[model samples]
Target: MLIYTGGTFGMVYDEDGSLAPFNFSLVIEKIPELQSLDLKLTVISFPDPVDSSNVDIEHWQAMAYIIKDHYEQYDAFVILHGTDTMAYTASALSFMFRGINKPIILTGAQIPIGATRSDARENLITALEIASTKNGKVPMLNEIAVYFNYYLLKGNRSQKIRSSNFAAFESENFPYLAESGVKIVFNESFMNTHDPQQKLEFYPKMDPNVVVLKIFPGITEEVVKSILNIKGLKGVVIESYGSGNIMSWRWMEELLRDAVSRGIFLYNVSQCMGGSVVQGRYETSKMLSDIGVISGHDITTEAALAKLMHLLGTERNVDIIKQKLNVSIRGELTVV
Candidate 1:
């Protein structure tokens, strides 16, 4: 059965003009294509559907639990989620479920499912098909993914690149697992095969003691100092200028130096919408490299935040954390 969590794919415009999540179970009759699929589908939505922007680790945990609870009953699972945090959720689930044997396809739409030109029908139908497809005893897809704009991307590797386009998301530094067209041409070599012996487990705790500072023109050292001074700050993601450039101010250097000295995990990511963070390549960003800031490579802020939270919650080895942050644990980033 397909699980429809609250997201844009299931939202409807009310008579009063406000948009709200609808009960997807009630809309099965509206989509005639669903009947043709000949799959037994059931949807379970949150009583109050949340916007993807508001999605947090708690919601992620709940979603994981739901899937685990019904893991055996369903042939495969399709999650309808909000686009804003879909990649984050997908990334988190990649680590959360260690040995998922079934396809857990997460998908959403930019436009509402009810709209005449909405992309919801295609995305949802395709995701469901991908989830259910199998080779006798084996499922076609055995990992977490996001299906959007005719592409199935590794959930952790994707970032939303546009706000208005039907193709609103992209997986930076990674190729798509499959693209939908006249046929679903999958990159079979990239597909993950599960080990049946391993079990599904959920990591629910996420530390929120992280902060993201985006460096830009006129960003004062005082501002950096003030944020570093926040009590019990566990980690900071510095969104530096292109190629991870930052002001080499004496005060800024000292502030970062102090923060690192205090055992705060420092991460430097590029501020540009795309591209990887290249630490120590240029004079401007050399200070950051010397100050012991870990490079975040091409990870998006959304993925960075979620990854930091998960890392902080599970592990206490700072050196290991810093190393893993740069590495693509689930294809979320590319480490240079």
Candidate 2:
């Protein structure tokens, strides 16, 4: 089954020469080769296609419900999403579909299917093939993934690194689950596998009372205070400079402490693409750990934000939420 939420891959040139989303009813017609895959295909598309940038909590919930409703009928699922916010959606789905035993591959293209040099054909074709992979009636991959430019990456670990290149997404903290080469090579060792008997648990409650504050060299005291002290804020993901380093000012520490004291969840993640957040490894980051900030070890900011929202939405106890944030739930982080 394929779910379309609108993206460049779904667009075509209209009579006016402007790109518009093509009717999903003709999705298979656009690629007749899909018929040769020897599998029955079904597609579900949003009534109104949304630019990935405009995707929100409601959209995420809708998609989750669709999967939950039809999960029993489909062998696996593939989603066509916009590349702009595909990482965020993919991360959210990874957390939402916690124990799914079937592959849910999320894929998108840098160019439209109608374009002369489009990358859409290969992306969609390979994604469908991967989704159908099975080992004696059991799905080989049982997790959410972003398949782009011949690489299949863990959904939560992926980030879009380029806009123009076909190889736009990368999983920096982890290795590609499978590389699409002469033959799609599955790196079974690095791939996340799960028990097929585990009942899929849907975590649809995502609290959006979360914010990310990326630290800059000249970050101001007032700026920190304003964000940390924001009313009704449940969680904050601090994108601290390389290796989770922040200014070691007394006032800065005091404000962070205040947020924790107020029972607001706080997480420290690195702004760097590849390294883990070793919270106490430096004097600047030491106070963060000492003051109740949870270390998001090697977690992408996108995943950190999604995890925080998921934790805050489902767990009420401050202590339990803090513990879960530092722990790896669905391999989103490498807990130190």
Candidate 3:
């Protein structure tokens, strides 16, 4: 069975007026190719499927609970999600499920499945195949993944880079785990990260009070202070410039130091889309290290924010949370 949590892939223009949600239980009828897979498939969906832009922690919990409820009945699960927040959802789920051993493939299309030029058919079919693959008498994929265009990426490592292109998602810090072509070439190096003896545990509490603060050349001190001053803010992702460089003004340093002193978890991530945060690698970023800013090594802003929310909600100690942020919990980052 599959889960279609509304996104552009499931949307269709109705004769009544605007775009209304469709029933995903009849997915096989919409794309008859699914029936040809020789698999027992079903679908469970939210009452009012939402856009990725509107996705929040509550929706994430709803999705997780749905999977938990039907964990034993389905061989594997496939999610049709909006590309915008797909990576964030994937990252959150990686943390939500502690010991996963079943495929949870998240996929969507740049065009609607009903549209004449839609790319949804191929993506959904390939995703289902990958989700159902077995190896040596057991399931092949046992981790969260994102399948789109023709690439299969580790869920936590993927980010949506394009709004209109068919290849709308990319894994910036890591390579694709598998690319579906004539054969699904599993990047054996990045596949099947499960131990048969381990048991799966679910943690669905994700706090959403984190904020991303991007540093610019002339970012004012008052602006920085105001952001850090947000009441009940559990975490802040400081998007630093260049190789994690930031303005070295005294006011900026004091504000950050004060925030850290107040026990707010501060993470430093590179503003550049492709590189890791390299605190103390240059003179400009020395203050970041001095002020105890945790480096968000090679993690995209989307993943960074999702990870913070996951950790904040699940972990209690602030210092321990900071240390775990530097570790690659589920391949979301490369810790320095």
What are the runs in model 3 whose C-alpha is more than 4 Å off? 16-19
Off by over 4 Å in 1: 13-20
Off by over 4 Å in 2: none
TM-scores, all candidates, are 0.92, 0.98, 0.96
RMSD of each: 2.1, 1.0, 1.4
In the range 1-336, model 2's lDDT, one tens digit per residue, is 899999888999999889888898798899988988887899889999889989998898888899999999998999999999999988998888877888889998899998888999899999999888886778878899999999999999999989878989999999999988888889888776768568988889999999999888878899999998888998999999888889998988899999999988888898899988898788999889899888899999999999988888888888889888888888888766
40-131: candidate 1 lDDT, tens digit per residue: 88877776778888887788888888888898888788888988888888887776666677899999999998677899999988998888
Q: Who wins the lDDT comparison?
A: 2
- lDDT by residue for model 3 over 1-336, one digit each (tens)? 688898989966688656666787778888998888898888778888899899988989988999888888887999999988998899888888877888999999888877788999999999999988887667788899999999999888888889979998988778898999998888877786657897879888888899999987788988998999999987999998978999888898899999999988898888777878888899879888888888988988877888898899889987689888888887788866
Q: Extract clashing residue pairs from model 1.
A: none
